[model samples]
Target: MTGSELKKLLEDSPEECHKLLMKEYGRYVYAIVYNKLRCCGSREDVEECFSDIFAEIFIDFEYREAYKGDIKNYIGTVSKHKAIDFCRRLNTVKGRSVYTEEEDIRQLASDFNVDERVDSSELRRILLDKIDELGEPDSTILIQKFYYDMSSNEIAKNVSMTASSVRSRCSRAMEKLRVKLAAAGITR
Candidate 1:
């Protein structure tokens, strides 16, 4: 049915709208949710995400107001977002493989005797301290983005920022780290 028809049905009889919504979009929403969660979630997780997507469609104002286009687009958008949320929650709650790309910044070669050469361990400590100084979400964003190789969207979910904002923060954080590392005799 058209979004206008659905909106009218929602106003006149919400129960019927709910029924019709389930009848029409249930499988479509489930498919989107399933595609997102298939690798990390159980059957129960998929069902819960499916239910949440419909619940969000029912309450979210944007979904209700935007009847100018096909309602299928609205339903699909809602499904995609809800599934992403589920993916973040399920993947985070489970034990993830702690694989981090080694930070590849190389320390400047020292001219001193072998016995007095700069210790790699000390440089690593300085690097970690600099990252800690960047503070909460910035540090977290950097670790998620570079260390864990997460996309900006995935990192934004964890940090509670928009994807673009996350990307910008990541850029700023990297620049700051580059300067700090340079001061510490580490260069990219």
Candidate 2:
């Protein structure tokens, strides 16, 4: 369905609009969530995230519609934020140090900047290979989010979900990925 059609659906009955969203835009939403949270979760987790994304859209229908702009872009942006938030929450609950203070950032820069002459092409290839090991939807999502930098809201509207959902899923996905990367000895 076209954006205009989806917009009309949003204006119509809530049930109708939701159904349309599920039928039409589910893939885009799934892709976005998968991209963000795939590394940190199982297939079940990805599915749950996808469902939540849609549910958020349904619940906050009015709030979403109020934002003016390209629906696809909005959805992608929102989903990315939601995914990031999820990762932060998960890290907090797990008692993991996800984001360090500025001191840590400075330390990283100091330590890694010395090797600025190193080639990144190999690292990029390896990362892509690792991402390819994920399941169908998650793999697609990760590539889009990390490799392509597509926003969650943009992905959401493409898939028909709430922007918030996209953000949370992306967060969870990234967390999972960090764990995987660490396990693979790709630490910072």
Off by over 4 Å in 1: 61-63, 97-188
| Candidate 2 residue-wise lDDT, 1-188, digit = tens | 55566667677776787787775566567667776776676567667777777777667655655645446665666677777676666567778876589999998888874354454646665666666665544555666676556787776665466777767766766677777778777876
Candidate 1 on 1-188: residue-level lDDT in tens? 88878888888898998999897777568768877988889879989999988888887632547685478887888899889988988878885645544442222233334644456647755876798789878877886676456799999998899999998998999899998889877995
RMSD of each: 18.7, 13.4
Residue 40 accuracy (lDDT) in model 2: 70
- What C-alpha lDDT do the candidate models reach, one value each? 0.79, 0.67
Q: Which ten residues in a row have the lowest lDDT in candidate 1?
A: 103-112
For model 2 the TM-score comes to: 0.47
Q: Which ten residues in a row have the lowest lDDT in candidate 2?
A: 113-122
